[model samples]
Target: METAIKVENLCKSYGSINAVSNVNISVDRGKVYGLLGANGAGKTTTIECILGTKNFDSGTVLILGMNPQKERKVLFERVGVQFQESHYQEKITVAELCNVTQSLYKNPLDYTELLKQFGLFDKLKSPVNELSGGQKQRMFIVLALIPNPEVVFLDELTTGLDSRARRDVWKCLSNLKAKGLTILLTSHFMDEVEALCDKICILKKGTPIFYGTVGEAISCSPFEKFEDAYLWYTDEEGSENESV
Candidate 1:
């Protein structure tokens, strides 16, 4: 498959602390790539560098063959980002928010259709603050997808959601993948990663402990469940002191 995003020798530091060190990742077009790690494991830092929101100490980063730093304007047009936490005006209605976001992109998706796809069609006029956690997350996803982006970066997409809502979001993401959108996602939930990701990368302390298919990652561990494998790979005693 064609590469959608690539990171080589990616390193970022804060003072003497290395946030990400010699990290490398490749995301293929039309695939969901999961970035899994514990808190403070450098997953967010890695993504910020890839998105050009944060400068790195040294490394090469590419999105669809364009340098994120050099082609930021062009890159922003083709890629969507849903941060781990996002806030909107308390009284802003869902429809109103969509209209504003739609205006920013030249090739925006149909707001009505997108809302329906996310099961937020009936909540179009509801204020953002009034929506449930799951609904808000869905709305945020809709906002990201409104630009009709080729690649999307989602951080903790289903965090704080109940199990039923999380499953619903998973189904929505699976549909997006089926429609050929490349997605890069970060999450603490291993089950979510297993359900949505075609490929997986497990990060520990600014280093990649595993990078390959989800099945391959599972096989590398002694456990049968993906969650168990994840814990083992990130465990201090179990993790090797080497990057993948």
Candidate 2:
């Protein structure tokens, strides 16, 4: 299988503090890969380094067989990203935002169709800041899909949604994966991880303690359930010095 993203010996630091250690991850084409970690475990830092949004102290990063930093303009055409925290003009209507995003792509998908699929069609005329939290999230997702990208980086895509809405988003993303889109996401919800992730890398203090399928993770830990195994893997008191 082709690799959509690769990171090797990735390291990042802030002065004397190590924000991320030598983390390595590879995402195959058409797979859903999750980066799991508790708060301050460097999940976001690793992703930022991989995406070329932040510089690293050492390592190699590649996306779609190209160097992200060297071919950023070309990479932008093929990669979609939805940040954990997004900001825009307070009065920018959803429709306007959608139009602007689609304009950046060479052959964009229909933003309206994407919006309708996410149940955000009626809010096109509403200002982004005025929409509810879930609506804003759906809108960001819609914008990400507008690029018709081959790979997507979603930072906590389902964070603010109710169960029904989160499941709806999952269904949509699963469909995208079926059509051969590679997704890399960070999430805290175990159900969300189990439902969408094909493989996961659980990080502890910026180092990966587990990297494999959910079943393998369950077998590695003392728990039979994926959620329990995940908790076991991430708990600081359990495996602070362990790496797998």
Candidate 3:
């Protein structure tokens, strides 16, 4: 299988505090890789380092066989990232925002079609801040896809959305998956992980407890349910050294 994203011994520190330590990940093309962890497990930090948005203490990161730090311009053209938190101009309309984002790319995707796909077509005239939470999330995703990226990073994609809204986004993502778009996402929701991830890396206290298929992770744990198994990997009393 073709590797899309690879990180070897990725480490990051904030003076005395290590945000991530010896983290390793490898994602195959057209597959979803979930980064599972609690709020302070270094999920976001790891992603930021891999994306070259933040400097890392040590590690090698490659996206589509190109180094993210040294070849950021070329690498980013084929990558899309939707951060956990995003700030947009409050007064920008969906169309206007999409138009602006589209201008940045050499060969942008059809934003109008993307808006339609995400069910934001009717909100073309609606201001970004005026949209509902779910709609806003969908809009962000739409903007990310404007680049026609080969790999997309979604942090907490469905965090605050209602069940139906989350499912809606999942359905849209499933469609993209069908078209062979690779995805890397971080999430606390096991259901989302189950629905999207083909493989995962579970982090605990800035360290990786496990990295492999979901079934492998569960088999390594004492529990059958993914949520229980995830907790098993994160809990201090649980076996953090076990991996598949």
Candidate 4:
């Protein structure tokens, strides 16, 4: 399979603190790659470096055969990103926002069809601020897809959503995967990763402790559940120290 994103020996620091150290990742085309980690584990830093939103102290990053740093303008046109926290003007309605966003892209998806598929057609005229948490998230997904990007990046996608809403968003994402879109996502929710990700990278203190399929990760750990497996991987030392 062709590689969609690659990072080699990526390093970044904050004065004395190393945010990302010698991190490496490879995302294949037409697959969903999950970046999983506890708080302060450098997941965000690694992603920012790959997207060229932040400068790494040392390393190389390539996105779709082009250097993101040098070809950002061209790269961005083919990539879609939804940050952990996205805020739109409170006064703008869903339809209006879609219209504005579509204007920015050369070849955009049908705004109406996208909204309908996400079950947001009825709320098209509703103000962004008035929408519920789930509605807001669905709207964000629509915006990300409007550009018809080949690679989509979603950070903490289901952060504030309820169980039902989270599942709804999962279905939407699964649909995208079915269409053979390459997706890179970061999330604290292990279940979300287990459900959506074809390949997983588990980060610990800026280092990848585990990189493989979800089943492989779980089988390697003593725990049966993904959450416990993740906790074990990230907190093994802490757990050992506490036991001692």
Candidate 5:
């Protein structure tokens, strides 16, 4: 159980509002950590802080035992990131993108095999802008995994795809974790979290309202379903704290 990521009292503010406040999070290696939060709940802000893409106003963030803010280059080598929204040059073929990303890493995985695994083999010669939304999403996912990174970040990964496509992505993600890749994902989809996550951290208004295994979160809440449990927790916080 190596600690792949750690945070203590993490805070980020946007002028008069605190997007993330005194957040403490820790993710062990080789497990899927689902960050469950609604829009504007600071889930993205917290993720950005962890990846060193955004500077926090205060507190500490460590990824792979290195300070993310100060050791970004060192941290990136072992990290794969798939942003919530991703795109590429219109004329760039999928295979070209894969090859370019592969060249950036010292030891990349087999690009062709990865593309095949994600059902993007036929789209290899297709331009990114010409592919269907699902195909494009698969392309981005393949790009992320091609580096054979130790940890991966997937933010709202299944948004535009249909049910089958989303399930395919989930299968790919599951396989990555089986290969001992630590994954941290943020999603508003409770069912997705329940199906894919080993543990979950429920956030409301820039703070952790609950942190535990998926089963634990469900068991501790007085609700019939996970979605109900989430609403119950956040609604309670909203009523009690007002600002939250």
Candidate 6:
């Protein structure tokens, strides 16, 4: 498959602490790639640098064969992003929010279609603050899809969602993958990563512990459980150092 995004020796830091260190990874076109890591392991920092939202101390980053730093606007046109948190003004109606996002794109997805897909068509008149947690999450995802981007970045997409809502998000993502959108997702949920990613990258302490197919990674372990394999790969053999 052709490459959609590439990073070489990427590094990011805050003050004296390094967030991402010498990280090299690549995402292929029309594939779903998962970035799995423990909290504060630099997954978010790496993505921020790749998307040109944060500057890296060193290394090169490219998206769609264009340098993100040099072609930020052009790159953004083809990329959709859903942040780790959902934050909207309390008074903004769902429809109004969607309409405003649609205006930012030269060619946006039909707002009504998106609302229907997210099951928010009936909640269009409700203010964002009035929606339940699941409904709010659905709204955020609809916003992400409105741009109809070639590449989508979902940061901790299922965090804090109830099981039912999480499953809904997964279904929506599967549909997006079927449509051939390149996806780069960061999640702590091992099962979620395995269920959705075609390929996976495991990060620990600002570095890649492993990068390969989930099946291959699992096969490397003597244990039958994929979660056990993950634990082994991360060097958590009944060690106290292991923490999610």
Best by TM-score: 2
Off by over 4 Å in 3: 237-244
Local distance difference test values of all predictions, in order = 0.89, 0.91, 0.90, 0.87, 0.85, 0.85
Q: How well does each candidate superpose onto the true structure, as a TM-score?
A: 0.93, 0.96, 0.94, 0.92, 0.93, 0.91
How many clashes does the backbone of model 1 have?
A: 0
The superposed Cα distance between candidate 2 and the true structure at residue 78, in angstroms, equals 0.7
lDDT of 2 by residue, 114-174 (tens): 9999999999899899999998988888887888999999988898999999989999999
Q: On a 0 to 1 TM-score scale, where does candidate 1 land against the true structure?
A: 0.93
Candidate structures ordered by lDDT, highest first: 2, 3, 1, 4, 6, 5
Residue 82 shift from truth in candidate 3, angstroms: 0.3
Off by over 4 Å in 2: 240-244
Task: Name every residue pair that clashes in candidate 1.
Answer: none
Report the C-alpha lDDT of model 4 over 1-244, residue by residue, as the tens digit. 9999888999999999988888888888889999999888998888888888898999899889899889988888888888767768869988899999899888888999989987889998899889887778778888888989889988778887889878878897898788878999999998899899999998888888898999999999998999998888888687579769
Better of 1 and 2 by TM-score: 2
Whole-model alpha-carbon lDDT for candidate 3: 0.90
Tens digits of per-residue lDDT, candidate 6, 1-244, equal: 7899898999887899988888887989888999887888888888989988898999998889999879988888888888877877779999899889999989889989988877889999999989887788778878888889889888887777788778878898898889889999998788888889989888877888888999989888787777888878766454446543
Assess the local accuracy of residue 210 in candidate 1 as a C-alpha lDDT between 0 and 100.
Answer: 89
Better of 4 and 5 by lDDT: 4
Tell me which residue pairs clash in candidate 3. Answer: none
Please identify which of the two predictions, 3 or 6, would achieve the higher TM-score against the true structure: 3
Q: CA RMSD for every model?
A: 2.5, 1.9, 2.6, 2.1, 2.1, 2.7
Model 5, TM vs. native? 0.93
What is the model-wide C-alpha lDDT for candidate 6? 0.85
Top-scoring candidate (lDDT): 2
Clashes of each: 0, 0, 0, 0, 0, 0
User: In terms of lDDT, which candidate is stronger, 3 or 5?
Assistant: 3
Candidate 6: misplaced stretches above 4 Å? 235-244
